[model samples]
Target: MSYPLRRRLWAAALILGFFVLWEVLCLALQVSDLILPRPSQILATLFSRMDVLWPHILQTLWTTMIGFALGVIVGVVIGALIGTSRIAYDTAYPLLIGFSSIPKVAVVPVLVLWFGAGPLPAVLTALAMCFFPIVVNIATGLASTEPELEDVLKSLGASKMDLLLNVGLPRTMPFFFASLKIAATFAFVGTVLAETVASNKGIGNVMMSASSNFDVPLVFAGLFILAFLGVALYVVFSLIETRFVGWANRKSDFAST
Candidate 1:
C-alpha cells in the first residue's frame, strides 16, 4: 500500500482497537451504566436524543466559531505589533504574561455579570481563553527569527514594513497556525464552561441539566459530542495548516523520520 493509504488504515485500526479495549474493559468490570456507560451506550443515547441535542450543539458551535475568529484577529494584530517592536515587546510582554497567568475560568462570572447571561458572555469567555496562546506563539516565533536573516535584510536596506511583511510574517505563520489548533480547543472549553455557568442554551447547559437530573448516559453523550467537536475543529485547522505551511510540514516530517 502507498504511505498515505497505510497511514489511513493505521488510524482506523487504532480507533477500532481503542473501542474494542474500552468495550472489553467495561464488560469485564460489569461497569454500571450510571457511573460509566460504555461507548455503545453513549452512542445509542446520542442517536436516540439527537433531536434534543442537535440544537444545543449548534448553539455552542456558533458561539465557539464567532469567539474563535474574534480572538484570532485580535491576537494576530497584537502579536505582530509586539513581535515587531523591541520597546513594545519589553513593555507589553510582562503584562501579557501576568494576565495569561491569571486563571481564565475565574473571569467567567465577571464576564457574565458584565455581558449578561447570553451568547455575548460566552463568546467573550472563549475569546479570552483563546487569545493568549496565539500571542505567545507568534511572539516566540518572531523572537526566534534568525539574526543572520535580519542582518541580510538590513544590508539590503529593507524597510521595517518590508521586513515585517516579507520575513517576520512568513516565519510566524507556523506558530500562528499551531496556536490556532490549541486555541480552537480552548475556545470550545471556554464557551462550554461559560454556558454551564450562565446560559440556558448550549451543550454545557444540556450537560448541566443531565447532571442535575442524574442522566449519566446523557451527560456522557454531551461530553462525547463536545469531544467530537473539538477533534473536528482541530482537524480542520490541521488541514488549513497543511495547505498553507506545506514547506514547514515537510521539514517537520523529515526531522521526525
Candidate 2:
C-alpha cells in the first residue's frame, strides 16, 4: 500500500478505536446520560437535532472564516511593516505582543459592549484570537530573509519593493500557511467563546443551553461539530500549504523519511 494511504488508514483506525473504547467503557460503567453520555447517545443527538443545529453551524463557520480572512489581511499588512522596517518593529511589536497576551475572554465583554451582543462581536473576537500568530509568523519570515541574498539583490540594483515582492513574500509562504492552521483553531475558540457569553446563536450557545438543561449528549454533539469544523479548516490550510510551499517542506519530509 502507498505510504500516505497507509497513514490515513491508521489514523482512521485509531479514531474508530477511540470511539469504540469510549462506547464500551460508558456502557460497562453504566454511566448516566446526564453526566457522561455514551458516544452512541451523542451520535443520536447529532442526527436528531441536525436540522435545528444547521443554522448555528453555518453561523459559526462563516463567522470564523470571515474573521480568519480579516486576520490574514491585517496580519500580512502589519507583519510586512514590522518585518521590513526596524522602527515599526521596535515601536509596534511590543504593543502587539501585549495585546495578544491579554486573555481573549477578557476582551469579549468589551467587544459585546461595543457591538451589542451579536455576530459582529463573535467575528471580532475570532479576528483578535487569530491575529497574533499570523503577525509573528509573517514578521519572522520576512525578517529571516538571508542577509547575503539581500546584499546580492541590492548590488544587482533591486529596489526594496522588488526584493520584497520577489524574495520576501515567497520565502514567507510556509510560515504564513503554518500560522493559518494554528490561527484557524484559535478563530474557532474565539467565536465559540463570544457566542457562549454574548450571542444567542451558534454551537457555543447551543452547548451552553444544553449544559444548563443538563443535556449532556447535546453538549457533546456541539463539541463534536466544532471539532469537525476545526479539523476541516486545518485540512484545507494544510492542502494549500502543500500546494504553495511544498518545496520548502520537501527537505523536512525527506529528513523524516
Q: Against the true structure, whose TM-score is highest? A: 2
Candidate 1 at residue 44, lDDT?
Answer: 98
- Per-candidate RMSD, Å: 3.0, 2.6
- Per candidate, the number of residue pairs that clash is 0, 0
TM-scores, each model vs. reference: 0.91, 0.95
Q: What is the C-alpha lDDT profile of model 2 across 1-257, one tens digit per residue?
A: 99989999999999999999999998999989898889889999999999999999999999998988898888889999999999999999889989999999999999988889889999999999998899999999999999999999999999999999999999999999999999999999999999999899999999999999998999999999999999999999999888778888666664544
Best by lDDT: 2
What lDDT does model 1 reach? 0.91
